[model samples]
Target: MQQQPGLLFTLASFVAMIAVLVVVHEGGHYLAGRLFNTRIEAFGVGFGRELFGWTDKRCVRWRVNAIPLGGYVKFVGDMNEVSQIDPAIMALPERERRGLFAFLPLWQRAIIVAAGPLINFVFAILILAGFNLALGHPSSPPVVDKVVEGSAAAAAGLQPGDRILSVNGTSIARFEDIVTEVVTGVGKPVTLDIVRAGVPREVTVVPKMVETVDRFGNVTRHPQLGIVRPAEVIEDVGVADAFRLAVVDTGSIIATIGRTLRQVILGERSLAEMGGPVKTAQIAGQQASLGLVSAIAFMAFFSINLGFINLLPIPTLDGGHLLLYGIEAVRRQPLAEKVQQWAFMSGFAALMSLMAVLTWHDFGSVGLWARLSGLLG
Candidate 1:
């Protein structure tokens, strides 16, 4: 077996991953802002005190900050990195404020705000497409080789040789497709169209939540139907086809994320399963240890996740800005300054609270609390 990555290597991998993602995300905002001739004041990777930086010819301050958690692009006429409007900038004469972000047309502002998340999605798609072009697509026929006796598959009358046609009305061309569908539908009844003994039939199965423990004592729980498949087959894909498949795969991932979040909201999924920065770093390190390809794949997936999260309708996120812009478009006017401030403050608090909870969970997962107690005892 491959040796696990060391702590320092893990930390380095985590930082590298965050840094790359932040640069790409912030770069998106910077590019979009420049497109409309908006003046960018600063482009910094990470948050908090600046470690080192330099001003470019365009007068944009490029810097790397102390904290590696996230980054931002500070635009002219913005109060701070979050892009809040600066009253003084807004009050400037029209001609003097021409290139300021706050003075841009409403549509332009929306696009600039959205560019960050949109570019992340685009980048992920390109990475996946490249992988498909290089490695070809691997898949297996959606035929059940075996069904564990006590599994949901067997309970639903699934048998060896049954060919799955679709899951929950979505067509399934590969066994991997079935796995994706079933994994996300845990505890929920799934409708499957299948062919058994050359006869078309339908089956309903509810996947059981199963916990697996690895050799390192790490436990992971996922929903499973307990059906086995034959060896995977790799088929060469053309460039165009590779990109098309990549787009489809990206959409599927987004859908899965949405479904998982819905389950969490409905109390069907545990909060412990949700990972924060610490857990993410651990996973990043593990992926890095596997190989360059694995690490890159993780980056692509995480990029998609970063894009999706930022598009959420939370006040402090890109999505939140879009939400406000949407309301502005409908109202034909901007919201009052006090109201916007309150929204931003509330959103920041909500995000911080969520982060704290996830971080605590991360420490607990690694047995940090237990180790501390042991030391005290």
Candidate 2:
């Protein structure tokens, strides 16, 4: 098949992201199962035909499969003949009955299911903390990076080297402070004290309502001032600042995810705002092409996404399974088999439908259809 010049690179990145996330997610299940002494039949990375795998000490088959999208850990007896009311179990050999997933204690099963999502979140927090420790906290300094033409900053004669002193006479200590003031000051003229070209200057500008597009392609408006960070403003800080910045950034990302999800649920946002594998690959490829810093940043963002999605309370997801575990714990019994099957079917269908929509959007946004149509024409 003919390929786009850099298409393979993009696909590789997408695969890598999925593979790593799947391993981490499945590893959580494997660990939890081991802790509870549950029998693990197979732990496979990437679904489909097995490419290579080894037998672990516990006799579990550990292997990589041909598909790179994700992995799974099969628990013994998880869907055995006994649990499924299959007559096949009666005819099976005695050795096969020992470690079926249904035989495990309910508490153990719950823990095993919950661990996957928990690990994803833990991985995100760790990555955030590690990044902060390495790069230090990002300071919101009041410095101009860019002043686009016709923008509030440009209209106010703001220059790239300007250090903002105050916004509307309010003392600004950090860059984010200016943003906060600007967002709230939308449509209102605000005075800025700026130090530019080694001289203090004064400017006034109004924040404009700016349209913002999120990951899912939903658009919203917020106050914006077309000013960016100055290139020369890298203030050095101590370890304490780095740790603080990491925690703050992590919390901020999580809050943003929560808000985005809420918007989607409330119908304020559309599912198109969501990105599937195609978008991820394109983004990852773009980031990779940009160099190390950008790629690392993308990794951080992707990790947070991994954590967030896995926690959704949908059947076939870690969060959904955990929710079921909670119910089982309280009721002292498993949900009916029929109910579980239906729920899984519903969740799987929903996910597939979402994937199809996102994939179609991805192609359409990139003009793939137009390109193909042109060829036919």
Q: Which candidate is the best by TM-score?
A: 1
Per residue, candidate 2 scores C-alpha lDDT tens digits across 155-232 of 777888789999878787778767666653325678898898789888888777788764434344666778886433
Candidate 1 — which pairs collide?
A: none
Candidate 2 versus truth, CA RMSD in Å, comes to 7.0
lDDT tens per residue, model 1, 161-238: 999999999999899889888877656788999999999999998889898776445788788888999789988999
Q: In model 2, which range of ten residues has the least summed lDDT?
A: 80-89
TM-score of 1: 0.97
Model 1 / residue 145 / CA error / Å = 1.7
Q: Candidate 2: where are CA atoms >4 Å away?
A: 1-5, 80-105, 142-244
| Predicted structure with the largest lDDT when compared to the true one | 1
Question: lDDT values of the candidates?
Answer: 0.91, 0.72
The TM-score values for the models, in the order shown, are 0.97, 0.73
